[model samples]
Target: MLNLAPELAERGIAINAIAPGGTATDMAAEHTASYTPPALRDVPPEPVIQSMNALGRLAEPDEIATVTAFLLSSDASYITGATIDAAGGWI
Candidate 1:
């Protein structure tokens, strides 16, 4: 992703990657707690997701989108290869 960034920059373009730490994707639910699966079970999905995060909150999918917007914005003109960790601080 970094290499392409420079090439794309030739045209005054910017590039970045968004790494969502841990989210409750259906694919991730296949595994159980033994795998430390990201999704929560019967414990009420809302807050349990929060406790798993370092910030004590779960990240709604759109939250990541917001960060992506910022990175693609002129405000981040000097930024590249940056990662928007929109997992609500999940580790």
Candidate 2:
């Protein structure tokens, strides 16, 4: 994305990336159930997962999509060659 953004910007194109952290989704639920670390194995998933981020909770799907929408909209016309951290302050 970094390499292509500059070249694409010359043609009036905007390119960016969204790096989302843990989100409360079906896929996340399944992954957590199967892959939780041993230290957190016995603990309840909600609190343990929420505590992984500074925001104390996972992000909503729309929250991440909103950032993508903005980048695609004229509101972010000046934004390019960047990665938006939509991670809810994941640690």
Candidate 3:
């Protein structure tokens, strides 16, 4: 999606994709029951856990908000078609 930024800018249309890593939002907590531990793995990874991220912690909603604010403002006028990573190193 980010590769298309230059194209969008050429036509004067701003477009971007928000790539958020592991966030501690409500939706993530509800998906934990879907996994079952396989013997090869011994135990299931952290249940309802977003700990695999580089931060080893859940991301606050405010972090996403800040990215959103930046994306929507005039200050980001030149940042079209960019994928803003709001995740805490979940990538």
Clashes of each: 1, 0, 1
Global fold similarity of model 1 (TM-score):
0.63
- Please give the CA lDDT of all the candidate structures: 0.69, 0.86, 0.71
Alpha-carbon runs more than 4 Å astray in model 1: 22-41, 45-51
Displacement of residue 83 (Cα, Å) in model 1 is: 1.8
Best model per TM-score: 2
Task: Output candidate 2 Cα RMSD.
Answer: 2.1
For residues 9-89, could you state the per-residue lDDT of candidate 3 as single tens digits? 888878887888766667765554345445424554454344567666777888888888888899988887678877677
| lDDT per residue (tens digit) for residues 4-89 in model 1 | 88888888888788878565555655544546544534455557556677877545567777787889788899987566667666
Report the lDDT tens digits of candidate 2 across residue range 31-74: 88788778877887668666788888889899988988898888
Question: Which ten contiguous residues of candidate 2 have the minimum total lDDT?
Answer: 41-50
Which predicted model would earn the best lDDT?
2
The superposed Cα distance between candidate 2 and the true structure at residue 66, in angstroms, equals 0.9
In TM-score terms, candidate 3 sits at 0.67
Candidate 3 ranges with C-alpha deviation above 4 Å: 2-7, 36-51
Better of 1 and 2 by TM-score: 2
